[model samples]
Target: MSSEEAAPLLCAGIATFNALKKSGAEAGDMVVVQGIGGLGHLALQYARKMGFRVVAVGRGADIAEDALRLGAHVYIDSNKEDAVARLQSLGGARAIVTMISDIEAIAALMGALAPQGRLVLLGAGKNPLPVSAGYLVRGERSILGSITGTPFENERALDFSVLAGVRPRLETVPLERAAEAVARMKSGQATFRMVLTMTEKSHARP
Candidate 1:
């Protein structure tokens, strides 16, 4: 991987990788990756390679194709359907790796967990996340936050990524065009991960 490809792995890759490791889900178990942006996309790939049945939850149909391509066995468009019901229909997820910061949206997904399920949170929202005590106690479900891992863990993630062919979808721009890249990112027009390179060459990918 080039510098651009390696950049996201250092941050989003290690973050999602650590989150999934904390999930306590075993192989063949159901795992849902909520949100299909930078972190979520990498989570999907990691979850699938880890041998879990991957489900990707995101807004809009536009992301469905990419989600499926990324390794999700099923892609749930939250805007068109009830994600909880959909997840339930497939037998509740053993672990849910969430990458979005919408507190209410995150709260609503608690019901989609199977017994002893774990909801690994990677996104941090300003508002408090509302979760029911009964829900956790009854099903033995739990929620935990995860950030990037230790340096050794990061190395493990990188090794796994290389062995499993897991990579971030990147849109690279030269340092001279950093302002343009920032604008695109702010507008949500950036495809996935955007890297600002010191070199004059760009590495924009599909």
Candidate 2:
């Protein structure tokens, strides 16, 4: 993979990986990753390498095969199947590393947690994630949020990425086309990641 492809490891990858590490997810734990974009892909790989049984949740079947290839033991296509029910059938997730800002989506998956399971939020959203007091009390479940961590954790994410051969699939564009890339990303048109590469010509442009 190119440097452009590896750029997200500095941000998205580290955030998700750190969330998983802090989620109390042990070997043989059932871990679910919500979303299959930049962060979720790496999350799936990291979860698998860390010895957890990985389940990848995405909106559709578009990412199912890739999620499986990335080491997800199960793929939950939220559009076709009920994510909560599917996870429940597997005895619920020990930890869910959610990478989406969709509050409803987050709310929908909270019930899929096992007792003492946590929902770790790596993506920020303007809306609040509402949880019932009874819900938390009943299962002893909790929600935690993680941003990119200290330099050491960042370095660890990179080192682990290298060691585990976890990599992001990328779509590279010249720096001059950053706006186009951003639009594509915002539109959810990027099949995976969009990376911007710097060049002398792009640097020289006003």
Candidate 3:
């Protein structure tokens, strides 16, 4: 997608960038990123640019190389290795930013946080995250939900996107094929963000 295509960035891009900026994780701090799709992809780049040591976690080995290419210092396949244990071995993560809606996935990563570390939830989900009281009290860890950012934050996200070359990988389809694009996303077949283009028909219509 072109630089002018800012729709996806306004939503997913700023959401992840703002979460990382507010996470209190500094340069060289280990930050765990959950999921490898839309938001997670952008989060990896932003976290790296923010100077955090990024560990990208996903379901399978399929995305391992892709995550690394996206600036992850390490890639963890949750299906193969215990994500919490893996993070613990690395001295725990300063923050875990999740872009997937799976409650259990979120709960699993909560245990992998360093003391006082934060778990930022950016994905929408209906299920409850089952975190124990002792986990929160012992480490002073926290769980937070993030929505889209303000106009200023959005502008910052855009500026960073240009400065850091943090562009979203997108698949563009004609406006008439919007439904097909949605289906691709729903089926987990879309490797990146999907954008719909305005056709000549669109301009000619009301």
Candidate 4:
């Protein structure tokens, strides 16, 4: 559990990201993680703490800056630059931890991955992945289907998030603003997370 009632925003995100970290990251590895928002940004921080050289791909410079501040070695503005080639230039990545399942994005990242590397899917989109068999065969690469964080992992995520000050830059909205917060998250506009706060007494949630 998180420290504050509003903290579930980052709490949920930290959970998923850590699972990806545990699955594919190692000390001193080059990592090109895709999608730097919501759960994606938390993944960047976890990657950095794991001693990986992280390259975060996303649309906003603020998100990039936040990633860098959180320990990412570099941040690629996917909007202005070629996302695939940008990741490609990073050489062999141990794994591609992605939250974007767009047809082209998935294809590009899979192709750019290193031999024996893994490409884990973390997106919540309903769109089916458009991948070619060649992408998986060439490098002996693997794809992983990861689920949301577990209670055990969530506990660890909270500890790490609190100790490391891995604050997910967020805009806390009241219950009334819940719709707006959801919209922001849905539109890919929420920087790191969208917290919906309640005015209930402290320790309100049992």
Candidate 5:
């Protein structure tokens, strides 16, 4: 893998990998990835490769195709359909891994989890997460936060990526254009990830 490929694995890759590991979801179980952007995209690939039935939930129809291409068995458009209802209809998710930080939005997804299922959080929002006791007590569903891994775990994530052919979809920009890249990322215009390369010219690849 080139630097562009390896770069994301170190950050987004490890984060998602660790989140999945902590999710308590087994192979053949249903796992939902919400957000379908930088972190969620990689999570879908990892979950599929790990043998989970992957479900992707995103806000637009535009992302549906890419979500499927990235290894999701089902893509739920949150804009047009009720994501919680759709997920519940599928027998609920064994684990729902999300990078979205909207606490209200996160609260809404709790209903989609199967009994004892977990909602693994990878995004950090400013406000407190408003979770009702009934949601946790009645179904035994739980929420947890996950961050990047240690050096050894990072190596493991990389090794797994290589063995499973998992790679981040990336757009590379010259180091000189880093500010432009940052601007695009901040504006949510970046397709997924933007890598700044020291090379004179930069390119994009799958």
Candidate 6:
């Protein structure tokens, strides 16, 4: 793309990604990202960049550091304490990105929202989730699923990516080590992302 086109792409994308902060995040609003890995890290930075007070929630010392580095105003160590109470004391986040699919965790996270808040589900579930109906119906809340962006939206996301200087923190393994990489990701040892690469002579092994 030409230099002229580049600015438009990035600006539009950044503007669009910033849209996520709307409805829930005003200048003083609190936002929570439920998992500080991969997309959760991006959500943290996006929440911050859009002027929300961000609470990064997850279960590891390593993740706390990463979330902080990604611009979370605070980090919740889910394993060490009651995440719902902690977030509630923070004035209760008005929006959450439900990156972990644990039913109880999602329910708690949903309850952690302020009235009229939103929870956007960003992860694929390991099992069927048992989300509580009361939280949504009584809290006047919304739960949404976000897939990849529209073509235009995709460009916008990449643009926000550029503006936030956000890139997936990735670990690379050779194509032959693909299975191991998946295992690492499943084990939560992969810091953010696990990527597989192919050599010039590698076969199309799908």
| Clash count list over all predictions | 0, 0, 0, 0, 0, 1
- Candidate ranking (TM-score, best to worst): 5, 1, 3, 2, 4, 6
lDDT of each: 0.91, 0.87, 0.86, 0.68, 0.93, 0.67
Point out the higher-scoring one by lDDT: 1 or 2. 1
Number of the top-ranking candidate, with lDDT as the measure: 5
Off by over 4 Å in 3: 1-4, 199-206
lDDT-best of 1 and 4: 1
lDDT at residue 163 of model 1 (Cα atoms): 95
TM-score of each predicted structure versus truth: 0.97, 0.91, 0.93, 0.80, 0.97, 0.76
Q: Per-residue lDDT of 1-206 in model 1, one digit per residue for the tens? A: 66678899999999999998899999999999999997888999999899999999999999999999999999999899999999999999999999999988888987899999999988888999888899899999998999888899988998999999998998989989999999998899887989999888776665
lDDT of 5 by residue, 1-206 (tens): 87789999999999999999999999999999989999988999999999999999889899999999999999998889999999999999999999998888888887899999999999999999888889789999898999999999999999999999999998999999999999989998787999999988876687
Model 6 — which ten-residue stretch has the worst lDDT?
A: 197-206
For candidate 5, the per-residue lDDT at 106 reads 80
Worst 10 residues of 1 by lDDT: 197-206
Q: Predict model 2's lDDT versus the native.
A: 0.87
For model 5, the superposed segments whose C-alpha errors exceed 4 Å read none
Candidate 1 error regions (>4 Å): none
Candidate 3, pairs of clashing residues: none
TM-score of candidate 1 versus the correct structure, residues matched by position: 0.97
Off by over 4 Å in 6: 1-24, 126-134, 198-206
Give the per-residue lDDT of model 2 (tens digit) for 1-206.
44764688888888888899999999999999998887887888899999999999999887889899988999999999999999999999999999999999999999999999999998789998889989998899988999888889888988888898888766777888889889988998775677788852322110
Worst ten in a row by lDDT for model 5: 197-206
Prediction 6 TM-score vs. true: 0.76
Residue ranges of candidate 2 with Cα displaced over 4 Å: 200-206
